[model samples]
Target: MSEQPVPVTTLLDDEAFLGTYQPDIWVFVQRSLIIGFLTAVVFGPLIGLPPEYWLPIMGFTTVFSAFIFDDYTSWLNHRADVWHLTSLRLIYENGNAPEQNAAVNLADIHATQRKLYKNLRLDLETGQSVLMKYLTNPRAIERDIDIARLALMGTIADEADIPTAEEANS
Candidate 1:
């Protein structure tokens, strides 16, 4: 039996789907660890537990809180924080809230900058900026965004003008 290809889903009318960007799994893991550690530190001392039990209590609390926080963050925050790149625009959807969703036209993007710590910053022509956090391989994503922006602005005249992945790497 032959395997069939999955269909690409586009978010916008008349726009081709380029890619989808989500926060890296490591980001969630780090967040969960930090929050869990802080929680254990803050509450472990208040319970009036004996010195001998403090280590075990704190360890259990850290693990429990980390697991719960990881699940909650993954479901509520990480899943909703997505960037859908269409041929024409960058669509951002925040959680389950429709009012928080936004779309930025590729043509209006002045430049894309890869900031410190997995953040991609989009500077707009209007002097405004949008920051996307915890993106995996943000440098490559920045390049992809630039290529899309150039294509939308009619700067790329031919397919040959666009660099291949190998060429880009070199």
Candidate 2:
């Protein structure tokens, strides 16, 4: 399987978001529910009240939107790439797209880095990184990469699969 680069905006498309079984779906939905609940708690009871009372609700909800929903929105903007590793090269494709963005020969890969913050960040040896946010289990992603790397190392390269350094030097 090859890995591909995808645009951050591609998340806006439903097909792109659901194509992969991103465990983060629950986290995103749960956070959204929390935001909705918090908004309701602060304002739902006061909605029918007088303007003076509803003022507080409006203020609280606004703050919640700015703070909590902002995080969610950022998560929503995030994207994850599913890479395909062949015998000789890595093929990258957007989890959302059918076409590949680019291919990196195994020998050129300087390093593979994974960052686990609020989300899962996959960085290629090429310095390109993809952020998969709000995932329930980030370790799984890291493990997959580790396995991929090992498998790639054992897989022999073919002339048609990728250009060798010797060939390049020639």
Candidate 3:
């Protein structure tokens, strides 16, 4: 049961906060390439933009559409996303979508499970759980959660920490 709790803070600057994480951009890049190809083949001729200008037009359209539409969501999701562990809670921020960000108190997390080896599922006390997927390295996050869980269980008195996976790896 992992219902999200209200976020007490938007983006924490405290050292305890693990810091913001931008998901891998490979998917976005691939999609952009596909969109560009299709635009050049179809929209270019249809718009009478000229054969010579097709590539430029396609490139502009691809980048423009991506940034305004696809990239906007992804970029905002990446930029606004935040996650961290505090003594009292396991915070997961999924960017501000209509201001829907929330947190989950550590004490409220009854269980944590790794799903499909790359997904982190958190079972909350309320019988609702949150699954964090597409995590570049779920193992690292899983390990951090475990450490924080241990700390929450009185195994450690000081504040807990979740180490960020290396940027290159993540």
TM values, all candidates: 0.59, 0.41, 0.49
By TM-score, rank the candidates, best first. 1, 3, 2
| Model 2 superposed RMSD (Cα) | 13.2
Give, for candidate 3, the lowest lDDT window spanning 10 residues.
Answer: 159-168
Please give the distance, in angstroms, between residue 68's alpha carbon in candidate 1 and its true position after superposition: 18
Question: Residue by residue across 11-117, what tens digits does model 2's lDDT show?
Answer: 22322221232434566656555665566666666565554565466556555774765854565444444444443444455554545455555555544444544
Candidate 2 segments exceeding 4 Å error: 1-23, 29-69, 79-118, 155-170
Go through the candidates in order and give the clash count of each: 0, 13, 7
Clashing pairs in 3: 1-124, 1-127, 1-128, 2-124, 2-128, 2-129, 89-106
Whole-model lDDT for model 1 versus the true structure? 0.71
Backbone clashes, candidate 3: 7
lDDT of 3 by residue, 1-170 (tens): 32434445754554255433334455446556677777788988887777898888778878987877766575445544556666556666654653666777777887677775245788888999887654566666766676666676776555334333453136
Worst 10 residues of 2 by lDDT: 12-21
**Per-residue alpha-carbon lDDT of candidate 1 for residues 77-164, written as tens digits (9 for 90 to 100):** 6555778787899888765665777889999898777776677899999999998877768877887787887788787886668765
Cα error, candidate 3, residue 11 (Å): 8.8
Q: Tell me the TM-score of model 2.
A: 0.41
